[model samples]
Target: MKILIPFYSTYGHVYKMAEAIAEGVEKVEGVNAELRRIEEAIPEETLKEIGAFEAQKDFAHIPECNLDDLKEADGIIIGTPTRFGNIAGQVQNFLDTTGSLWMEGALIGKVGSVFVSTASQHGGQETTIRNLHTTLLHHGMIIVGLPYSFAGQGTIDEISGGSPYGATTIAGSDGSRMPSENELEGARFQGEHVAKIVAKMTV
Candidate 1:
């Protein structure tokens, strides 16, 4: 099965998590995975002035996601950094253009999963993921989440981001932090769970 991962990351944390998730999908035999990013909404001049553009350049090699990619995927995983308890505007804008897909139920019955990164532990990870879930559900996609079967979901010894909602990471206020191995484990589990489910459904 082919799984498409579409995401928007400002400081690379979400990208790292996406890589971990790709690794998990690869672990499952016969699952094909590809990474793509949403279109940038930020103006080039502003992005350069604020340093977010330079950071984006590091990931420029990744292809821009298009509606065709969404239409072609057997399974989809979305990753986005939180913006005030909501999905980033870039992700929102990308989804906004999928009206035709939603109208025809193009994504119906497909396995859809999400992962997120936030600036703080309570930086609206749940809300952001839930919002994405709401959108995917509208398209008639089956939602997949990072279940407690993953150790990171229940760990009391460390700060973590996994929940029944989805996998997550705390990127710190300045967006300087990368996802820890624990958080990446959560992302990996999310990927593997979605891959297995897609496998079963496709078979």
Candidate 2:
């Protein structure tokens, strides 16, 4: 099974989260993850505070997955950095362009999940994950999330990453908190969980 992981990252934190999620998805036998980044029309700084030196280089100018990837995948997982209690402009813009896919029912019945990173503890990570869920629901995709059974649920220090809605990372104030080992494991568990569910449903 092929899983498409499409995301947009500003400060590289979200990108690392995506990578961890992919690692999880690949852990399941017979599944592969396709990692794609949303292309911004105009290049932007990787972090607003970091200035030019930290600007993210533009990827190919495409939004989400190419139609071909969406058509081919058995599942999809999206990631984005939080922006004022919502998804980043780049991710939102990319999702907006999936109208044709929606009309064609290209994404119907596919398993989907969302992940996000925030600069603070209350930076709207849950809200952003829910927003991503709304878009996936509109496309008739099946949304999957982290189960409480995973190791990190409810633990004090280990509770910072992954959520019942999906996966997430708390990047701390400087956007420099590398995802902890627990958080990384949680992300991978989410990916593997979704992929396993998709496999069963498809079979």
Candidate 3:
């Protein structure tokens, strides 16, 4: 079974979580995980001016996701940083291109999940995941999320981003914070959980 992890990250925060999710998916024997980057919507000059150009280099080697990638996967995990309580425009742009897929029901019954990064602890993490879910539901996908059994999402000792909606990490206002171990663990658990479900469905 194959699972595609398609994501857009201005900084490397969401990318790190994507890697952790891939790791978890790989732990499920017979499951293959693919990481694909969403095309950048910003101009090169603008990306340089905002420092996103440099930060994006870490994931530049990843392949850009294509519609065929979506069609072939048994499951999909989307990772996007929040943009004012919603998905980033780049992610929106990518999803917007799926009209053909929706018309043909190409993604029907496939497992769909999401992960995210935000500038603050309460920065619309749940809303962003739910907003993404709307698109998945329209495509007739089976939605999966980070279940409460992950346990790390309930910690009160530190400020972290995670919920029943999805896995998330707080990037801090200045974008210096990387995903903590707990947040990454949540991502891994979600990935593995989705892979397990997909495996059974495929069988």
Better of 1 and 2 by TM-score: 1
List the lowest-lDDT window of 10 residues for candidate 3. Answer: 47-56
lDDT per residue, candidate 3, 94-156, as tens digits?
A: 999999999999999999999999999989999999999999999999999999999999999
Candidate 2, backbone clash total: 0
lDDT of the candidates, in the order given? 0.90, 0.81, 0.96
Error of 3 at 128 (Å): 0.4
- Model 3's number of clashes is 0
Predicted structure with the largest TM-score when compared to the true one: 3
The root-mean-square deviation over C-alpha atoms between each candidate and the true structure, in angstroms, is 1.0, 2.7, 0.6
Q: Between 2 and 3, whose lDDT is larger?
A: 3
lDDT of 2 at 174: 76
Better of 1 and 3 by lDDT: 3
Model 1, 1-203: lDDT tens digits are: 88999989887888889998998887789998899988888888988887788788878899999999999999999999999999999999999999999988899999999999998999999999999999999999999888878877888898877788999999888878789889998888888889999888888
Clashes of 1: 0
Q: For each candidate, give its TM-score against the true structure.
A: 0.97, 0.89, 0.99
